[model samples]
Target: MSAAPLTYTPLDPSGFEELAAARPDVVIPIEQTPAWIGFERALGRTPLGIWAYRDAAGTLVATASFVHVTRRFRESVVVINGPVWFAERTPAAERLLMDTVREQFREHPAVDPLYVRMQVATPQAPATGPIEHGWYEREIVVDLTPGEAELLRSFRPNARNSIRRAQRNGVEVKHIPREEWKEVFATQLFPIMQETAARDGFQAFDSSYYETLLTVLGDHLRLLVAYRDGTALSWLITTEYRGYSVYYFAGSTLEARSTFAPYLLLWEAFRVLKAAGNTACGLTGIASENYPGLANVTTFKRNFSKNVVVVPTTYDIPLDPVRYTAVASILAARRKAPAAARAAARRATGLARRVGRGRGAVGASRHS
Candidate 1:
């Protein structure tokens, strides 16, 4: 018999969940989940979804969900960690899926997006296909299959020592229950997040964004906080699905640095997630050439595991090349502004210190 033809159809959250459930071996990204779609909706992003299936067998083979965003009258569709394939994925199929999505979006009356940007998030290695890869990144995956002793042995000496120190210092890691999520975020998580952002010179999402994530993802998401002497020192938010967990978001206090709470916090996360039946935990998006600003956090993550994986880079399908270029340039500048500003501030401070020292030297010479 001839093979069943591939068919494309509109997909809803329930349909996407069914496809995810059917594919056990594939690592379906947390960002591609139905809960994430709900979170995006809560954040006011319009959703666009599609699925590819076998016509004869009615089996889902692929799924992609995108958020339609408009800024300054320029529209864009963004797919983060998605356009996932459940079956054998060929370059041709990948091209076809993207082509179909582009056509659908173009035909839709409500949307006239300048481009569609898809950031590859999969267990597969980087592709050598027509999808011109950009924004390359490194991700570290910790194998939770090993015993605690073996796990500890895999880490860098500093990480191992820090974990031990935190333990000795009486740092306690707590898994916040669902009922306490609202209270926890309002009182603890959001405040710590703001402080981290201010110290690190990055923007933090609003409280509602996290609240929606915690509420919608429910059991799939775990918020683990490290406490020292009854004071919250560090926190990690991880999402679990199909025996895998993603180290999603985190924040640490200055006390966490001195107390080594972050190290113990991650170690505890590994134990808790492993005990919850997860085989691996992904310390998502480490520092890379494309994202050098993450160097500090990357140093911290490398302490735990060296099982680095190269994820496929993002690709853009420009519907209107001219407008896409214009808008892309604007967006890129907007993204870099904060980093540039921080660098400028540092330079200014250094110059001020040098001038002060020069004046002091002249004053010492006059006294002499």
Candidate 2:
């Protein structure tokens, strides 16, 4: 009448696929893992992954992974992203895994102030234990079960108008073949992304990383290109996760903005999701608070659906509160310095260019 003991193992890259398939609810897809891995690689960081196994009477009952974030400023938190366990073993397995992770984290000085962030896609919140609590995170979800006409009617007036204008203006939208799209994206979108990142003060992934993703996800990933009068205007990359399709990335030319090519591209993506029998679409990563231009972005997304779910921004549980705060403040300051420098550089460059142009004009007039 004794309970069975639990076992823990370090999850290797090879084992992830099989484990993920065994328990879909608790596991994120293989494609998602690569994206995260690619993110870490690009940033020059590595995360630790620990897998939990429960066996009762020599029979395997459950499995889960404890993922620890490894970064210079944010090294203390170990996020338990997508832990999978069988339905029958939920309570016991969850408790055991949680306890083990807490103990493990306590022993390691590197992992102080440990916290696990888990996202359940359903509208209803999951039960939380003594160690865990729920926080609000928002996402704009569009129900795709309805026909195209119904879907269009569900949109707000502005969204509908934009869609109409895009259609009327003859902005053609279609899926680009993966191989061909890769080439086009590398040549056309990469430079735009680099410029945007430079202006916005962030880093962007290299083209090879995106190409790898498109190759792995295949049909589940789509590249929607918007064109007007035989000229490419904008493009959007979408990925399907579970029953929902997400608008992952998009890029548009300055010319495209005048014709509202992005509006047409998004409408086409939604239509494609509906046609493919997806249940919903996710307008991902729109900031809800404390950022300029975020409100405009949020408002634009809100027009498409009534179900606006806000996701919690990234959280931190500091181990050394005093030290952590000091480091965090320093990092924040570092992030701002680049933007200020970029702004100053731009102004100086503009002034120099204007002065040079005036001198050139004056010289030409004198010669004439």
Candidate 3:
């Protein structure tokens, strides 16, 4: 039988949510959710719209949400962890979805994107024609279906021992209410994040970004803090949608190392998410050649589960050939130059810090 013709159409919030709910077993990526649109806006990106492909029979087949990011001289539309498929997905359907979205952006009155970068959510073979772009090469997801005891037993012996040691040290993990986020970020989470960034050699986002994220995501977000002797030791942020949860953001203090507070915090997170009926929790991305910054945390996360998941690579579709090619060339040179300079600066800064007493300094790789 021939498939019914599919038409590209705007998807309202209610329809988007209903289609997402249709696949209860599949965990929808937070980037493709309606809430993500608000998040992009909060981050100063231009929200295009959420769209879907519907068949003649009116069944929604696939959907995606787009956000326009204008960075300095470059402008591009980004689709992270989408376009989502609600029915059996094929290359033809995927191609049609991508083509139609590009058309939509081209016809958009407000902006003309230099290119569109799409990171497909489904794991099927990637569609052809778009230039392949890659971000975090792999991620780790843990199954929460097993009973709590079994879940705890599944972790590496080291991870299990750390959790136990944290408990023995009188460490406690607690969830902070949304009403208290601002103050907590200022007093606890931000300081811990700074410490973690310094120890790990990375720059942390400003507190305003997290404040806005908590404000916008609201109940869909959760903050878990590990405490020992009435002092904050470690903290984690997670976001839940449908039946899926993600280990969104996290940090710890030097004091947390001895107590193993992060370990207990993760164990408690598993129990809390399972109790809330989430069947899977994405530990987000792991260490990869392209993103070696994750090395430290990846080793930490791997002690919990080894279910490494390889996600689809991103594809870039050029809308304006002239500008796209020019920008691509400039970006290639720009990337190498800045990276070398930054590495040198970091080394000098690290040495200076050792000599004296100085201090300094999302998407899949972004948040991970």
Candidate 4:
């Protein structure tokens, strides 16, 4: 017998939850969830469409959520790992997903977008090696299927011993409830994030982002705090996606470094997520080679497993090449502005320091 026909139709969040409930293995980030799209819409983006692919038996096999991104009057329909499939990760299934979305974009004039950007978020590595295709191009995943001892056994001695030492020093990890998320953000997490960004030379978002995330994600958002002697030392922000938990954000106070609270905080998070039945805990994106801090973070992650995976780069399917290229170029240029400014500031400071030293030497000669 021939295979059943596959067809795509609009699906709501309820339908998505129903299907996802049946297929627990289809773990996708909360951002891809329909509720998240709704939150985005409430915050001003146009939600273009939502769809589900079903077999002839009328069972939903895959689901997708689409949102229209408009900047300076230019627009694009973002797929963002939509059409999440419950079927095996076969080429045909992936092909159908791409083909269906492309065909829809072609036939529908109302959904006209310069290009469709699909952010890949799968465990399976893409056929393409590495290119630019993600909000973050690389990430780390820790196996949580094994028991605590087995999981700890996989860690390098440094990470393992640090965690043990932190515990021995009376570091305690606790969950911060939603009501107190704002308080923790303002009082503890914010200052540490500022310190981290300054030391690492990265831009840090204000506490409002965490506030909105906590308000929207509700049960899916998990905040873990590492404390000692009544003082909060470090905190980690995580989200419970389909089958995995994502390590979204984290920071530690300067004093906490000596106690290694950050390492124990991670181990505590892994334990909680594993006990909650997640198959693995994704460390999310670490720095790439191009970034100076990548080495330190890469080594930190490798201490857990050498099995670090580089996910498929984000794919941009363009309908209007000229417009797409124009917009892409502008966005890329804007992204580089911050780094350029930092470099310029450093050069100016160095020049001023040299001039000060030269003047001081002449004044000393005059005194002699």
Candidate 5:
């Protein structure tokens, strides 16, 4: 007996829902495509997506998209995120699709040093050697399977205390209606984002991008806002996918710190997902050690959730050796420059503050 031949094609928008239905166990949601499309639209670019199908059978088996990002170091890299496929497909099929995608890029003169970065939701790790990259540990999990009481008991004592304190302080959690909340988001959230970005030396999504996402995803998107004494304190944006809820984006006002509003917000999200029959609550990308005070955050999330999943940083599969080396060199330089600039800025600010205080004291003595 021989296996059926496979055919590769470009994925059409109409087939997205059916494809999503075929792979319920996979986390690649229908909205992910639209969300990527939205990102391309906002950025004014078109990303290449490759879909694998059985020859002439017309039934889709696997799908992957390649997004090309031009780095500051002048390197052209492609990231392939959320690659979804039927469980029945063999490892050979996945390899074939990847090879085809690489060849397609090679034919393009402008698409030099094509790199493939993937984060699969499946538990089974794919075999390596086709790409020059190392695999870090990754995970896909379900939390609601344990039930709510068990979930609460798993949490760290401080996390449980924070949640209880928020509830005791009369913190209210509610879904912000898309229409009414858009205006508040623009006014209240944008400034905080701008300040945070400036302080941290990173860029954030433009206000319009978030607005577009809300309109596109509709009910599948949920905005959990926490309030105390009629004042907005903290909020989190979650997306429901395949019987699981992912806590994607979050923000908080400084006033919320004292009341521990985020703890209640997360707890409410967990309760809502459990009631809706969702099997898991994904506490999306938490740093194990990098960010300041993030260990505390990681501990907090782990208390209510048993799965402390550490997903790999994206893996790069370089198609062109010369181009890949050039890009890597440039990225190393770009990262170093930022740290140098931040250190210089801190020293300059310290000197200016000292000079200003000295001048002010001398003038005050002269006046006296």
Candidate 6:
């Protein structure tokens, strides 16, 4: 008998949730969920397309979510960690997805994407070559299926101790919903983000960026904050989908270091994920051999799970003639510019500090 024809349709929140409910065993990343798409939309990004196909039983069994990002008018659609489908529906879903995406580029004036970057979350669509657009290649996935005793035993000795110590020392990790978090997030946690970015030498998003993030993520997002003696010490944002929860980049105050608040924060998140019936939790990106500075961070992730998963290579497949080459060339240039930019920034900051110190000394001597 021939395979049943699949009808593809745009996915709303309810439709996406229906597919999510249908695929209980599959762990679709939160980035491909409806809340994430809505979050992107709130940030002024266009949802290029999101489609789900119904199975013969009339259940939504497959999903493909894409977002349009325009950088200097070089537009592209990125399928963030998904194009999720059941194993049986892979072939039919793949054909419909490719056809629909191509149609969007060709016919839909609003979706004139220069390229399509996809990393299908299925065994059927394995990626190859270099990743053009992605957050990380390797991520740490911690198994949460084991009992609490087994989970603690799996953790590194130091990690286990830190969690105990944090609890004993009155360092609390609070799971605040979005609405409740607003009471303290701006005043207590926002500055920590800037401090973390500066200390780690990374560029951070604007203050307004958090508005889109917190508001649009809805219930899929969690605000985990570590506090010591009534003072906030660290903050972690976690997102859940299906049976998977992912830890995003977080911030920690200098005062939190002595208390080992970061370690405790992660443990709290792990506990919550396990209680939610999640089988695994992603410790987000970790350093491979390429980034030496991240050795310590990778070691921390390893404490919880020895299994480090490398997502398939994200390839940039061109759809347009004019902007694809332009964007590719720009990305190539940026790949080589980071180290030089860091060096320049350090030198400028050092010079500015010296100048300020010299002026301060001169003023002191004159006043005396």
- Choose the strongest candidate by lDDT: 3
TM-score of each: 0.82, 0.65, 0.84, 0.78, 0.74, 0.78
Inter-residue clash pairs, candidate 6: none
Model 1: per-residue Cα lDDT over 1-368, one tens digit each: 43434667876767766766777788888777777777788778887755554434776667777788776747778777876777667665565555666676778788888777775443222222212233337888999999889988999999999999999999999988889997898798899999999999889999888888888788688999999888888998999988989899899999899989999999999998988899999998778866778888889989888899987677677776666667667767886999999999999999999999999999999999
Q: Clashing pairs in model 4?
A: 64-83, 133-313, 133-314
Q: Ten residues in a row with the worst lDDT in model 1?
A: 123-132
Q: How does model 2 score by TM-score?
A: 0.65
lDDT of each: 0.79, 0.63, 0.81, 0.74, 0.64, 0.74
All candidates: CA RMSD in angstroms?
5.7, 9.3, 10.2, 5.5, 7.1, 7.4
Question: Candidate 6: global Cα-lDDT?
Answer: 0.74
* Per-residue lDDT value at 105 in model 4: 77
Give the Cα error of residue 287 in candidate 2, in Å.
Answer: 3.3
The runs of at least 3 residues in candidate 3 whose Cα sits more than 4 Å from the true structure, single-residue gaps closed, are 1-6, 55-59, 120-135, 339-368
In candidate 6, what are the lDDT values of residues 101-173, reduced to their tens digit? 5555566666677777775433232222222546556778889999988988999898888888877778988
Clashing pairs in 1: none
Error of 1 at 315 (Å): 2.3
Best-performing candidate as measured by TM-score: 3
- In candidate 2, what are the lDDT values of residues 1-368, reduced to their tens digit? 53545655655666755655666555243224544554444444445553545555544444444345544655544343344445453444545544554455557655554244443333121212212232324668888998889988999988888878888888888778777877877876666666655655556788777766666556578888888887777887887755667787776666666777788789889988878866778786455442343454577788888797655333333334456557667777887899999999999999999999999999999999
lDDT (Cα, tens digit) per residue for candidate 5, span 1-368: 43455666666666765766766777674334645665565566556654544444666666665566654444333444445666454555555555555565666566564465554333222322223332233332447766678777767788789999999999999877778667767776666556545644557789877666666665667887888888778877777766877776677766676898889898888888888878887775444433333444455456565566765344455567566667677666677899989999999999999999999999999999
The model with the greater lDDT, 2 or 4, is: 4
List the candidate 5 regions with Cα displacement exceeding 4 Å. 1-7, 29-32, 53-61, 71-80, 85-97, 108-113, 120-142, 145-150, 192-203, 288-296, 337-368
User: For residues 166-261, could you state the per-residue lDDT of candidate 3 as single tens digits?
Assistant: 999999998898899878987888989989898999889998888889999987888899999889999999989887899999999988998999
